[model samples]
Target: MSEEEFRESGGRNTVFIGRQKPVMSYVLTTLTCLNNSPDVILKARGAAISLAVDVAQITIHRFAPGLRVADIKLGTEQLQSEEGGTRNVSSIEIRLTYPPEGQGEAAKA
Candidate 1:
């Protein structure tokens, strides 16, 4: 799917956190929730998994306490290394869901 389409798809939104600062991911998650999105998925691989977790925590605890973790999926993917060897990298997907009626002031939107 196109990037734009992938972003504005119903109650679901996905944020891929990589080298960017954790604040960036936190802002995106908060905005997604404020925009009436019921679900937000945070994705990261390898070393970035901790960053993804921090984003999820900040979003749920600081920004949107009413939101809750709906699911978590973890796995490893095989990828080709630059040295022409195969490597397995761990990945994590964190799904957060807000209430159907929304949370606090966001409910009006």
Candidate 2:
């Protein structure tokens, strides 16, 4: 990716945060980011984690022909709730990669 394309993203694994939006919206965004970078990451918490997986699947299977899931990390985050109490929220990170020529599938990490 160019310096100015996604400056704040810092290149390589550009990140996309999941939310209440439709799955296709995220799918398109990941595809667009992949156009410039070699890898992309989709992150989500709580109920949105499932939507993140759907977005990754749609983008890898139906959209980008050669894209593959490279890695996946799951954990929990503690955050202060609106009522002032702490909460543990489940989170996930799906790293999607477009392997170099002749390195597909075998290059998964």
Candidate 3:
């Protein structure tokens, strides 16, 4: 969800709700398909969590080096069925936060 949408959800200041919100809600939007059997889990070498989590975590790390293990939050994970539907797979949707406002532009530098 967009930041605007998230803030509109509820509450007064529209500021983030928790200490973890800054890191947990950051996201890079993309769609990818897993080419393996739905039963197989994605693996990342030399990283924490499962391979799937590593995949997402590493991507975030490429941008946000300060990302702590505790900062990661797994949302929803699913497999695309042969019928073009989604099955709830073991893989998860990972979210990472972008740095504060001005840093967004700097991150691209």
lDDT, each prediction: 0.72, 0.77, 0.35
Name the regions of candidate 3 deviating beyond 4 angstroms.
Answer: 1-49, 60-63, 66-88, 101-109
The model with the greatest TM-score is 2
Per-residue accuracy of model 1 over 1-109 as CA lDDT, tens digit each: 2334333543447777776575665657555655765677887778988988888888877777887788998988777788999888787888888766645547666
- Sort all candidates by lDDT, best to worst: 2, 1, 3
Give the per-residue lDDT of model 2 (tens digit) for 1-109: 2223323544455555657577888887888888888889887778888888898889878988788889998987777778999888887788999877878765564
> Candidate 2: how many backbone clashes?
0
Model 1, CA-based lDDT: 0.72
- Highest lDDT: give the candidate number: 2
User: Each model's TM-score?
Assistant: 0.73, 0.79, 0.25
- Indicate the TM-score of model 3: 0.25
Which candidate do you rate higher for lDDT, 2 or 3?
Answer: 2
Query: Number of backbone collisions per candidate, in order?
Result: 0, 0, 4
Per-residue accuracy of model 3 over 1-109 as CA lDDT, tens digit each: 3334433543321122222323333223111221121112222112223544534555446644533332333433454568998765331323333345565555678
**Candidate 1, superposed: residue stretches over 4 Å from native:** 1-12, 33-36, 100-109
